[model samples]
Target: MTKVLLTGASGLLGGNILKHALANKTLDILPTRLGGDFSVPEAFRGDKEILPLDIRSQTWLWNIISQWKPEVIIHTAALSEPGACEWQRETAEAINTRAVKFIADLCEHFGIRLIFISTDLVFDGTKGDYLETDPPNPLNFYAETKCRAEEIVASSLHDYVILRTSLLLGASPQSLRSLDERLKADGEAGKTMTFFTDEYRNPIAASVLADITLKLASGNNRSVTGLFHAAGKDKVSRFELGEKLCQKYGISRQFYKGARQDEVTLSVPRPKDTSLISDALLTVMNFPMPSLDEMITALP
Candidate 1:
């Protein structure tokens, strides 16, 4: 069995990874979340316990690494909110960038492979269908941190896979983690949801991402190391995605509105088109990338 340590077990992708890992007999997984009083869905609470870990603390991280000695460390924890990252720059750097550096160092020292989750936001949306070779031009602090973390992972270890994904749509243990869930919650609260019509992304289902990530972590494909795009096949606008979700869940169109990126006053500037070309990873894994319609249909 491949002993795996999964960080950010409380997040959408990480939680999904934990669920899938639990079902896989080949993996003995340890899911870790930042120490807190947060409540997780029962589905994520499998036979294995979710350990409390503050990746910000190097000592705590070192102890976990030394004690567990996992063959693979799937590091997914990060300060993902753009506004929050801009407002709390120090905390974001410490969590997203510095912690990743620490993890990379540990992974190198212990000869453990690392699978780091990155974002498509690393590329300035001027260009869509980004390849792994595209130079990252992050527009916001959050993206900047993730880009830096990606560099750290790449430069620090040869046995690392930096998976850059776009907007994720799926159910999380916490209802607010995924885009669809957040939209549903907002619509249920009788709030008007406005999505940017100009902003585009190749959004993938969290389950799909988890499947690919676990497959990489399975130690069955050591040759898959390097940066790979794991987004959806459809390059869709945010407004289109929201509309689809509304249609799928029978939510009234009245609650949803489409506005251009320029119309809204955001705390940080957003890229216009961050659609990714996931052909590289999909081709290698022999996996089919799903479309937005297919993903929406599969949504629970």
Candidate 2:
């Protein structure tokens, strides 16, 4: 049985990963949450050994690492909100970069396999089909932090896979409002929601991403150490995605407008296209990557 330590168990992707990992009893999962509430699927509640962890604290992390020596550490915790990260640059840097550096140091010292989750926003998005070999040019503070974190992981350990993913679909256990849900709510409220037609991404369901992550972690392949793009096969703009969501959920399409990227002003610069090509991951795993339609269908 492989002992796995998963961080950010209360979050969207982390919760989904925990739910998936629980199906395989062979995986002894010790999920670390910020507080008492372990908000994963109820079916897998009994399967998890919850541990309270403050990922920002290096001392706390060291203590946990020393006490519970896990074989693999799936890092999912981060200050993911772009606006929040921009507002709280120091906090974001601490959580995203400094914390990752701490984890890398501990993992390297203990010979533990590390699976670092990264974002496609690391790219400047000038080119849509971003390859794993492509150079990262982060435009926002959040992306900058993740890019730095990726470097920390790469330089710190030989046994690590820095998986860069894109916009995630599917309902999270945290019940945090997703982009689709927000769009629906705005439409219901008789408000105009302008989606970007120029900005593009290849979004994947959280469950699908979690499944792929578990597969990689299960392989325990030391050779699979480097950056890999794990995202949807088809590239679509936010406008297209919004249209699909409206069609699928019976939302009022009239309430939204297809605006270009330059029309909107944001706290930080957003990439025009960060859609990733998963050729590197697909070559190794024989499974088909989900299309935009397939991902939308999987959504609740």
Candidate 3:
């Protein structure tokens, strides 16, 4: 059985991948974490060893690198919250940049393939559907670090795949639904005038996105080894997504007062438009990006 080591295994994206891995019982899924006590969740119902890991600690990580020698290493752990990263610069750099490069260097030393999960935030929203060749114009510190991390992984390792994904939706410990819930809660509590219609993203459902990540990791494809966009086909604004959710679940979108991004007091400046349109991924998949309506059906 092929053994795979996945960091951030308890996270939204990592959880989805863990689900895919568990279903293939023939494969050995070695998930890592310092805390949290649960199987990867959903379709993945496997035994665990509650591995104590802190990727930032070079000594501990290198030990695992030399011992584990996993064929595939999916690195997803990071301080992803943009505002949080803005305030907590040191922690963000340690987790997002330093730790990633450490693993990339290890991969470079020992022949291994590493799949890095990156974000669409790397672009400044000056444009959408930014290609792999596009120059990253990060608007915030979080995006800046992520963009740098991509470079670190690419230049550091020979066998690696860096996937730049857009807004993700699905259930997890800290799911992409966090933004929606925050808005919904704020609105319900009589807090209004804080939603943005100007900010745009091409969000893909977790279940669907998981398959794409796996496809990129399954085998060696140097052509697809570099950065690639992984997102949904349709691009929609935050307002539209909110409205669709309301319509789907029979709720009201009235609470959210639509405003432009500039009006908001976000610690990190957000990109105005970043709706990825990747024909690259579609060509490889048997069934490409799933429609929003189809996604709703798949939601738990």
Candidate 4:
């Protein structure tokens, strides 16, 4: 069995990874999380213990990595929220960039393969269909940190896959982790939600991403190393996605409002169009990237 170390087990993508990994007999997965109680839904927790890990602490991280001696380490833990990252720059750098550097060093020392999860926001959004070769021009601190982390991973590890993904839409283990869950929560709470009509992204299901990650972790194809893009086929705005969620969940349209990027005052500047072209990874993996409609339909 391939012993895999998965970080951020309580997060959306991490939870999906754990859920999918458990069913695969080829993988013996050890999941870890930080900063809170086990927030992953009980349904996804199939007798697996989620260990506590503060990736910011080198000693704590080293203990886990050295003791576990995993064949593959999927690093997904991050200060993902753009607003939070902007407000707390130091904390964001510690978790997103510095921790990744340490992890990459550990992977190098132990001869373990690393699969790092990055973001599409690394681009400036002037261009829509971003390829793996495109130079990153991050507009926000969160994206900037991820960009730096990507460089660290690339320089530190010879056998690593840097999968840069777009907006995620799926049934996360927690209520607020995925787009559908957040929208549904807002609807149930009688709150009107405003989405940016100008901003665009090729959002993918977290489960699909997890599947691709496991394929990399499975070690079936070692040639699929280096950077790749993974996202849905369609380029859609947040307003369009919000409308779809309303229709799918039977929520009222009155609860949803569409606004341009300028109309919203955010802590960080959001990209206008960060749509990714995932053909590079899709071609090699022989997996079809889903459409926006398909992604929404597939959500549980």
- The model with the greatest lDDT is 1
**TM-score for each model:** 0.98, 0.94, 0.90, 0.97
Which of the two candidates, 1 or 3, achieves a greater TM-score against the reference?
A: 1
The TM-score, computed over Cα atoms with residue i paired to residue i, of candidate 3 is 0.90
**Model 1: per-residue Cα lDDT over 1-300, one tens digit each:** 999999999999989999999899999999999867886777876767899999999899999999999999999888899999999999999999999999999999999999999999998999887898889999999999999999899899999999999889999988888999988888889899998999999989999999999999875576689999989899889989999999888789899999997888888988999999888899888887777899889988
Model 4: which ten-residue window has the lowest total lDDT?
36-45
C-alpha lDDT of all candidate models, in order = 0.91, 0.85, 0.75, 0.90
lDDT of 3: 0.75
lDDT of 2 by residue, 1-300 (tens): 888899988777888888889887678788887665445566434555667888888899999988988989999988899999999999999999999999999999999999999999999999889998889999999999999999999999988888999888777765653566566667778888788999999888888999888877875444577889999888899989888988887877677789987777777899999999998887787667877898788787
Candidate number of the best TM-score: 1
TM-score of 1: 0.98
| Clashes, model 2 | 0
The global Cα lDDT (0 to 1) of model 1 is: 0.91
RMSD of each: 1.0, 1.9, 2.6, 1.2
Tell me the lDDT of model 3 at 207. 67
Off by over 4 Å in 3: 34-45, 174-194, 219-223, 285-287
Number of backbone collisions per candidate: 0, 0, 0, 0
